[model samples]
Target: MSEDVLSQGEIDALLSAISSGEMDADELKEQKQEERKVRDYDFKRALRFSKDQIRGLTRIHENFARLLTSFFAGQLRSFSEVSVASVDQVPYEEFVRSMPQRTVLNIFSVEPLEGRIMYEVNPNIAYAILDRTLGGEGKSSNKVDSLTEIESRIMSRLFEKAFESLEEAWGSLVEIDLTLEEFEVNPQFIQMVSPNETVVIVSLNAQIGETSGMMNICIPHMVLEPIISKLSVHYWMQKEKTKSSPEDAEHLSKSLNNVDVEAKVLLGESGVSIEEFLKLNQEDVIMLNQSIEEPLVMHINNEPKFYVQPGKQKRHMAVQILGETRGEEE
Candidate 1:
């Protein structure tokens, strides 16, 4: 076929026009809109946790209560009454102090640091609960005006326990042992930040016999990113393991190799009355009367292997390989 060719000048003119913004206006607008969408892309924020992770956290919380309950068995009416309101992913510096007019107690906050998760613990009631549950650890109290030191110790221990649980649940996926710094009456205006740039908030709402309030534990997002990723990977691995198990994989390969082979076996005889048999004591032959020449039924892994006449293998019962059957009788 003869080629339809363009001259060098023609190609040069076309290139010059394209470089000089000669494209159709509508096409340019469409392309620009697509690019703009990509630039403006931002995922909506929400709370999420794997079932195992959530369960781990919940068990930790329960254990925390148990420890406290054992510490103050009769002092407090109920020592374990905190509920996790939410575990959310949030932007740094977004949390602010509660409104000045709002007389809220037990507000807590935390900011990420280079090697620590700093916590801001506030209010008297929350600290009181912590103190009662934590008990005294060789440190005597003198009824001080502020429980700053006591609150710090209690919160530090609680967060440390939580970190330990996280580490145990996720193994190397989560790095624990970061310092847990705590304070009392820290103003919300002061910013606590993390080097990792992201963190998780486990907000606990304390419902103590009608006196309700909330507290928070902020954990670095970087500390949990690896955990979340590993959870996803572990889930997929479990699914694959289940799919590729020895029995299941063998069955699948067998199905692919021979579609005509059936894996089920059928009983030749149905249920009959056992009481109808003659009741003879010694040397009585209550025979089944099955033919010796009949091929013996064989099974493999609880499925039919083959049917063959009974044979002897060094005085042990054995079977000879016969034609593969699916309990079909002609």
Candidate 2:
């Protein structure tokens, strides 16, 4: 009150008190800057998935989400749409703590990958499915605390089917077998990842007929470390581009038209010893397993391609294709 202009230190102290409510303004500012700063870049606490990896996983799981809806529609004969909600990286402990007290957590491993991953479905979704499967209306009002023995069994089947769909959806990227390791209701007891370890979470929101719920897939960075290269956009794009184009197919057909193919006709096969072969000198008959009525097998490039019968085509020893082998893929 006596001085017109206070000293710089006096002014700063008064300003800090007004700005920080008795705390040092500079200290408050510095504390705010300490949160998740990139400069802090702790190697032990790095992101589970990079931005690119998260984008790739988003693209991959979007397909899975769409397929999941269709699968539910077919099985439950109901309308539904499961959409990818978000892909994020968070500390594993944060995720575990966010889970409800009563939740069904499925721990599984990818056969082609090294470590385990987890799948968590909301209880509302589980109950809705249980009701639908048990011939009741597929709707829920209150959240379930725990699944009964019968309910758990039913949910296990549902989880199996969902994982089958997941396996099929992941087939193009990596042929993985999702085998369940264990199931738990108490998340505190489940320690799939260390408390501070980072994990990648892919969330899918489901609108199954009348019920709406969420599902999460948690994969620790360690599990994805080995095949992280496969999670890049370039790899997926190259795989798509490597498929035969129309021009490529035409060129292949034209080139094959000019090349010579070694074709052979086989009646059948019969087990004959080496001694029996030595005994046969000239014009010795070897009994065949296939009868005369049975069609001969046409061997193209040493592979049995088709069943054919010996016939005359324009005065040539040609054979007609009767049919193809059953259960053979093209």
Candidate 3:
């Protein structure tokens, strides 16, 4: 609003010029209009996603961060963390230039969508994961280098499993099947899109154990162009409102039923001192804490849940359920 108002000096100068017959008021208005600045827009680096769409991408990737964190924690068998650092739209060439000489670049395709997406892992993070997977302390080397054949295979399998998390994260907005298409170490080798093409980079800060590094997911505008309209707050909110049917719940229950769980029947316990245990022979007998009449405890996934009677059924050792145990108590 202040830009539209003229300062006292400017107003006085304008009035003086108008009264001097050197400048006509109507002509001055035309001159002012002609002097208006035009904002420069580069088509090469055009902003394909609006602020709302960017926020939507941020939300989608934030969910991906949580899923990836859980997946890595289980797969790496170590402490893992992932979080969305930033989301920015830039030219594809700039993204390539920003990448290191040697790093993990996984180009994957989203089925039912046209173009591919680049999932890049920084060298530090990649080596750390490789180190941890190979039974190291999850420490990365000071110098970055290309992965060996075996290392590439390991990483490919690891990230392929990670795609499940990505798919789940985007499940709300779209149903996509992500498949790894190619793995490359050099960014220069990547030419899936034009250098001037617009891409949205979702930077994720990932930490595996003590090692931390950046992981980026580069999505070109052409890939998202098909579903660009769905990347909006309104669309996302609408998707959130969709409710699952009873059949879906039934299907989920059926899936859970198929999952395997460890169940073991605990036998009677007996204690022995260190020296006594060391000197004990194979056939040596120790007095049991529980009598044969007492029912044994059955643990499901390490949690005591049922009491059972140990016996032989059809020449096979088995346990017959007596009753449910009251938690840890008898």
Top TM-score hit = 3
What TM-score would each prediction reach against the true structure? 0.41, 0.61, 0.66
Query: Candidate 1, residues 1-330: lDDT per residue as tens digits?
Result: 233578999879867876888866578669756765323433333345565665555544455444433433344535445556665555444444331212112222222213334333334334454555565322223232454665556655654543443334333333444443443344453355532244556666654433445656555554455445454555546645764579888899988887554433332443335664445568754455455557756655566657776668998866567787666632
lDDT of 1: 0.49
Error of 1 at 15 (Å): 42
lDDT of 3 by residue, 1-330 (tens): 125788999989988998999899899889888988887778878887899999989999999999999999998999999999999999999999999888888999998888999999998998899899999999988344645688889988888888789899988778999999998888998898999999999999999999999999999898888888998899977878989999999999999999999999868788889999899998989998988888989998888899899989999999999899986563
Ranking by lDDT: 3, 2, 1
Worst 10 residues of 3 by lDDT: 141-150
Model 1 spans > 4 angstroms off: 1-115, 118-155, 168-191, 194-274, 277-280, 287-291, 323-330
Clash pairs for candidate 2: none
Report lDDT per candidate: 0.49, 0.81, 0.90
With candidate 3 superimposed using the best TM-score fit, by how many Å does residue 30's alpha carbon deviate from the native?
Answer: 4.8
Ranking of all predicted structures according to TM-score, beginning with the best and ending with the worst: 3, 2, 1
Candidate 2 Cα deviation (angstroms), residue 158 = 0.9
Candidate 3 regions exceeding 4 Å error are: 1-31, 142-146, 241-330
lDDT of 2 by residue, 178-217 (tens): 8887877678878987888889889889876689999899
